[model samples]
Target: MPQLQSHTIRYANPILPGFYPDPSIVRAEDYFYLVCSSFEYFPGVPIFRSRDLIHWEQIGNVLDRISQLDLTDQKNSDGIYAPALRYHEGTFYMITTAVRGIGNFYVTATNPAGPWSDPIRIPYGGIDPSLFFDDDGKVYVTAQQGADYNSHAIQYEIDITTGEALSEPQVVWHGDGGPWTEGPHLYKINGLYYMMSASGGTAKEHREIIGRSDRPYGPFERYPDPILTHRHLNHPIQYLGHADLVEDHHGEWWAVFLGVRLTKDRYSVLGRETFLAPVVWNDGWPHIDNNEGTVSLDMAVQRLPLTAPSTPENHAAIVLGRDDFNEELGPQWLFVRNPSDRACSLTEKPGFLTLYGEETGLGEVGQITFVGRRQQHLHASFTACMSFIPVSDGEEAGLCIRRDEDAHYELGVRRSGGRNVIFARLTVRRESLIVYENETKAEQLLLHIESTEKEYKLACSEDGQNWLSLGSGSARAISPEDFVHKMCFTGAVVGLYATGNGQASKTPARFDWFEYEI
Candidate 1:
């Protein structure tokens, strides 16, 4: 494989923005499809398509119907974790972890931009489920499993058509010298089965580890050591790993992985984001560019001609915050937990989306409620204006950027003392609202948030003019975990939301507009 001329590692400025994580990419015909893990967000696993890897557009979602995915009792960032996307024999398959119930499930579709089928539950217990189809048509799925600290890397020969485990999963490797091991992928090259996974933790200590086996079922051998590791750095950036391998049409190899950028002290609030790196073969072994384990923020490489662009500048880009909800909801927006199609309406009107307030109260923590998109990029602002006649005391219509129940900022119109008042509330879980204020006549409040490389400032304006500073909030990027996950793949979305006790007639909030600026 001939390598392109050396260039700086250029990141396509946030292709999806907002909370998209653990990206899985597959090439289908002239288009490349990407899917990301959407935890607790309804319409799970948004599917995006790109003609060039740099430019991506949201097609639809794989888990639109509640029956398609299980999210019962799952909290924010806890339902679906890492998802694997692959096309085998005319069927596009997505395997993922449904953390709340039914462990792992596989969904299939004929079209990458799909009318996907309901999930076919695969009786397996693991996160980061991946599918690998061999030349013989043998389908295999790999995942990380262990009761506690003792975990093993495992894979199972699967029935591609039925999504069933054909045989018991066998342990291929264990984290002997490595720290918390997870995110496993299998590939075959030159008669050798290559297994790549992330080890160390999901922090700055992450590294990409490689193992190889002559057979599908591995008596696998670990590479002399990790093919890529950042363990050598004294004060390392949180490079904790989750990786996927991709090859271009030219047969050149590349790996897409997730890492975090730290800000002030030990805070990494941006969430784990996807990164690309070159891979080279050394004496039948795989090694990342220099095998240093950590991908450099300054490193640059020309994208393979066949690799789809993953940036917003691309034509296929999915624009969030600005909704003409008539078309499909772009991959950026997500509903809390498993969203009920009946809860909201899009596609009915050409440019309008109406959201009916669900029974869940916005104040309740961890409730299967609220639809939101991720907040991507540091210096981006989202604005949405809605008009609603509150039906009850709790009914509120507003805009919010939420990470979990505990951490979020909300600006909306709420009825108080039999009158509508503009209000802003910041909740950092268990703690009381950090900031709360009510304006007497805030006819239309444009909630503006500006995030810099270090901090975030929140402001509101009346008539979308003369912005008033509402004080700034301390923002710190955190790693993706059961609670806080890195914001990668998907950028933040600004749109309409309504919550509280009310019928559609009383709670209907007509969104005027939503805008996002980066």
Candidate 2:
């Protein structure tokens, strides 16, 4: 493949930031399309499109309908895994694993943004599934199998139309001796089959390794060392791996992978993000990010001319930090697990989000009444105005800074001691504590949560003008570094929630507006 080396342009490392991990990219003509894992959040597998590789705008979600996605009772970081997005013969196919839902499946759509077909289940038992279409019209599927050191890449021939197995699955390649060989992407470049897979887990030891073979399923030759990694480097961006390669219109090669930005204490609250790096080929193998073998936050690289959308309709209107509840929720909003239609409504009160408290709370595994957007910046502010009348002690509705079920902070209005009060509660490792509580006589409350790199400061106001400072919580308490083994693959989400501890709430919580800023 030819490489572009005209002039260098400066761009940020993580083109798509905040919890967008296990990235897969493909060039479908002049546009480059990318998809990422959504985990337990509904509307899984967010898709983005860009004329230039660096800037991306979310077009829509692949799994938008409830009938297509069954994330019922899925725990945090367990719904949608690594999705391999590929465009073949006028159709865009996304194959992935729904860890606790339907195992392996692939969905198709003629247009990148629209109503995608229902998932066609693949009768396979593994994560990070990918589909490859050969020039001879043959289809192949690759996935990771086994465990730990025994982990390796597996492939099989299948009919893309019906998801039928045409050939028995075969082990194609074992990684470069790294454990947990997963997120495999198979490509036929220059008449040679290349298999790229991530290994050494998804932590600081993560790296991308490759191998090649003459046939689709064969005894492949390993690449000896990782093509892309920051495993031992003292860089701000760590845990780089699970990459997908694409050839641009100008015959330039580029890679989009997952990496995390760490604080001074090596803690990352932003989770794994999607990053871009230039790729060059020598002889037959590929090298990523030049000879430095690592990528940084600010990179000067050669890329295609930036082509931003000219019209307002074509432009991605992702809200930066504020939502006025004037229209239906946008693509950036997410719901925990598979939420019911009765959980939230926009037309009930008109200009207000009405959340009905279900028996299930955030601490449980079942679906709760909540809607959130990913915390994109380390230093950001999230504020919401809610009018909730809690008649019972367990009924509450307010703002939440959530990392997961067990790791979250809630600031809301609830009935305590037969009176309404504003409260701040923190839950870590299944232990819950009410840190601050004060009686509030106002019917409407404005809750605010300010996040710094080190900690999160919470405050509230009854009149939406004067604020009363609630206590703060350490950001490290919600960081993924402490709970990687417990499947903490998601970042913090600032959300509005209404939940009844063990019973259904009689009155609904009406949120007039919510805002977030960095």
Candidate 3:
């Protein structure tokens, strides 16, 4: 890609779409680097780089190594929480909490793209941790202390080089009586310290609030109202909060936050996406989006020299639009938890991706032979050319749109009544039903999953010319609102999956190519 001319641009909100939430951004070397929270997904903390804040390109993930994270048997939305990225001096630091695993930890890398140091554990017992480097060569860690409505921001001094707590944790700022006072970020501007946090939970009442004081801790004055929110607004975008501020090369302030676009039924399946808005400093307090107070689908702002991302040629960055599986799997691909080496391969079959069926299925905590990418758009098309032969009745391989383990829709090929059949199965809340099935004689099949705002249409074809509709699954069924006791923090992901149901299979499914388009 070439560099975009520096000029004012008209762009849409949610600059980086899909389940990218709790975004933290920093400007280094005239470039902006960002990281987002990835829960229960392997290769955690997806990171991106941009010359202009309006446009971003995924460079790599922050937690790509297994040693940095372990999400084994972790439930949906229960792995890596809000991650804060900061560039201090010459090293880049990323700190986060590993729910159901480590309490809190930080990683260091000279380069933001790769080879981060093994997680250095922080003895803190809270989520959404952030590191603030002060002018006096001092670093402080600020995070949320309790859970839900009882949560409050806590701060402690830490030696950034050794990850050692130099001071005891102390209350910094209790929120404005919101349900969840989390996602704390500390910054110093014009000699005064500013503490920002998201409150009122992360759903309908989500809003960003800020407070300021002359010192890093204590006696802070809160801005009277939320800096940003869409709580009671009649708009398509809702659930807005959890923001990080950045100053561009043009000396303009901006904020990157998380917000969701809802369907007609007011259900969000694409998860909380990253949105950008201009920030203004008024009387020492920051205001979001020129006092509009809420973010929208479209945003026109003055950009700082719009420049297209020039990703390094050697970097295995995600290529937008389609993937032919010609090279190694890009950084955008993800597995359920800690994946086994035997689960998938790109070298087993040249120019193809091979998935060996594992004994575990999607609904189980066991590692399944599955590989997928985030469903970044509400209306998108995903198709894969797969050659799978099921030898047993329970062995199957095909495409799946997974919100979690219990809630997903699978379109696969299985052996039924001594014949090969293409089936569409809908499983929600541990209940499975084969909604549609058709007998097929083809050895190689092209599986397609077309998603609208309300439904997902599964279809199949042998020649890639003639297609047959198998069935459709309701989009609302996989949404967060449909859950009873379960949580839905992560958004929907569509990808290729293979399973043996109970017993391991000798057969392997080969996918020639997988393409996802918006």
The number of the candidate with the highest TM-score is: 2
Q: For model 2, how does the per-residue alpha-carbon lDDT over 318-385 read when each residue is reduced to its tens digit?
A: 35756889899988898998778788999999999999888898889987888998888899899998
Q: Write down the TM-score of every candidate.
A: 0.86, 0.96, 0.95
**Model 3 — TM-score against the truth?**
0.95
Candidate 1's C-alpha runs over 4 A off are: 1-18, 234-237, 289-294, 302-304, 307-321, 324-328, 346-352, 363-369, 439-443, 477-495, 501-505
**Arranged by TM-score, best first:** 2, 3, 1
Report the candidate with higher lDDT, 1 versus 3: 3
- Per-residue lDDT of candidate 3, residues 1-518 (tens digit): 97545466566777888888899999998779999999989899999988767667788889987899988888888999999999988899999999989889999999888889999988775899999999999899999998777899888998877888999999988899978899999999888999999999888899999989999885789998999987877778888899999987766788999988988798988888899988878898888842264467776665555455443432223255667788988878998887788888889888899988788988888778889998887888999999988778778899999988878998979877777788999988768899898787778999999999889999989899999888898998877667758767888888798887888867889999899876
Model 1 error, position 325 (Å): 4.6
Query: What does the lDDT come to for candidate 3?
Result: 0.85
Better of 2 and 3 by TM-score: 2
State each model's CA lDDT, in order.
Answer: 0.66, 0.86, 0.85
Sorted by lDDT (best first), the order is 2, 3, 1
